[model samples]
Target: MTFSHDGLRDSLTMLAAPPYFYENLRRELATAERNRSRFTLIRFQLFPRDEQASLASEESQYELAILSFAEVLKTSVRAEDLCARLGRFEFTVILKAPSAVAESLTSRVVTSWSSHQEWSKTALCKSAIVTAKIGESSLEILNRLDNQELIGITQS
Candidate 1:
């Protein structure tokens, strides 16, 4: 689930928002499969997980938070990589070629972001990786993410 806006909330199936999210996930999955790299959907667990979650006072503040999230994400990831809002705070990143290399890169990104000022303040993010099999597609990656077995792969 991706965190929603400036609040500690998420859209489970990404059913409530625009179709862009699914589109982004689908694109990232395609890229991952093609490059033979691992695609990890890092979902930042936001607070106030309820629908009636308190909305940030103004859209401006919300935008700042979103930008801040992006900043941290960029610093954590590679410039050639794709880090997008798959759902609110849920971002889908297609690690560049080589699964091992990608995994290492993601580790550093996660480690750095976890201690970043933004995350330290409680606006949280969690990560999980889904590797592509010979015939797997993006949807498969999405399904794999729901597998509880992968929970807490890397989080402090």
Candidate 2:
């Protein structure tokens, strides 16, 4: 896959950009179709803690929380897995692994991130995991996944 420098990576987190994420998702879908393989997509949303009103006013702190969470994601998944920043407080991972493995990793990541003393107090993460179907487009899968309630770190 070609990686264009422009919009290839998020400037704040240095993770894959939205365009890159979508492209990779499409490619992974095709690869799964061809090889009859399975892959899982994990979506993450980070929100400031309800009691942490100051976090919203402090831009630097908010950015640092995002950056730190991104680092945790980068370190948690395999190098071949695609990790992308979908929005200001959203991220995704394309894991070329079975649903079980994906689920385990998701739990592990949430645990690790929540236990971090620095940013955990300011923000909390909610995540959802969906495995790709045989005959589905990237958008279709994403839409379905989006409808599901993202499980919070404590809930996971």
Candidate 3:
């Protein structure tokens, strides 16, 4: 699919933008349906622990924390996996793997992000994982994942 430069990727994180992400998600869903294969979708969100104090005064730092967390995500997944930025503080990863493997990868990502000195202090990370089901559309899968209560990860 054709997309403007900005439409294809998020400027700050250099990850796929929503249009590109959804297009790929649709393609993946179709493939999974046809082949009876499974793939995992993980949604991640970052929120300031103390919004007023952290975001109001440390806007730049908050942005830097997002950038760092994005890097953590990028490095944690396989090269073939699709990583995308869904919103200012939201991201998603599409892994062509079974649910168990996806959960392991999710733990790695969470641990790496939480261990980061700056990122952990600046933002709280949360994630939800879902596996594509037979006959489900991309929107349906995404809606289910989004509706699920996110699992939060914080620094110890």
Best model number under lDDT: 2
Pairs of colliding residues, candidate 3: none
Q: On residues 1-156, what C-alpha lDDT tens digit does candidate 1 reach at each position?
A: 135532221233322233544665566666656776555454443332234544253445444555555666667676665555655545555554455765676567656655655543444445666555545765676677656243222355
lDDT tens digits, residue span 1-156, model 3: 112238788878888899899999999999999999999999888877775764536667877877898899889888889999887778899999998988898889889987886678778888999999999988799999989889996547
Q: What TM-score would you give candidate 2 relative to the actual structure?
A: 0.91
Q: What lDDT would candidate 3 get against the real structure?
A: 0.85
- lDDT of all the models against the reference? 0.52, 0.86, 0.85
* Each model's total of backbone clashes: 2, 0, 0
User: What residue runs in model 1 are displaced by over 4 Å at the alpha carbon?
Assistant: 1-63, 148-156
lDDT of 1: 0.52
Q: Give candidate 1's TM-score.
A: 0.57
What's the CA RMSD for each of the models?
7.2, 4.0, 3.5
